[model samples]
Target: MINKQYSITQAPNYWYDIMRGVEQGYSIKLTRNSEVVAMLVPAQYEQPPKQNFWQALEIFRQQVNIAELYDENVFSDVRDRCPGREVLL
Candidate 1:
């Protein structure tokens, strides 16, 4: 199993434009000589859920009826028609 942080940024299953590799993508045997505290990665946008969490979105992905809302602007019809599924609002 892959760790959540590495899976998103380093793994091929996620980001495409890889800028560089982390520590040459290798782990040296730690012998109390390693000098490090913590690490982190940059965030991505709009990517679907993976591993065990959902991606953070800026806006609502669902569709709305424009005629019913403004009567002038046409809203998208991207409705979630999941049958027999309990969805959290």
Candidate 2:
């Protein structure tokens, strides 16, 4: 990850540019009085990894019964729908 630093005084004026950089995948370091205080990154970077289909099913099964969790007919109508592309990995 790219790292960029800015002081508290400079941060307010350049906040938007810093956020845009973060959106483009940079990690920003914000400082106060020349001392590092905080770091900013995209939400996805802080989120936990997503479970695969089977793992998610298992978790749901543990919380509820298989009858409630399983739905074979749920995606029946999705075959004709358009599948969106992945934007980020």
Which candidate leads the pack in lDDT?
2
List lDDT for all candidates, in order: 0.36, 0.87
Model 2 over residues 1-89: C-alpha lDDT tens digits? Answer: 75799998999899899999899888899999888899988777878889999999999878987676788999998696767787886
Span of 10 residues, lowest total lDDT, candidate 2: 80-89
List of clashing residue pairs for candidate 1: none
TM-score of every candidate relative to the true structure? 0.18, 0.55
Stretches of candidate 2 off by over 4 Å are 49-57, 60-89
lDDT of 2 at 80: 69
Candidate 1 weakest ten by summed lDDT: 23-32
TM-score of 1: 0.18
Q: Which residue pairs show collisions in model 2? A: none
Stretches > 4 Å off in candidate 1:
1-19, 22-35, 45-65, 68-89
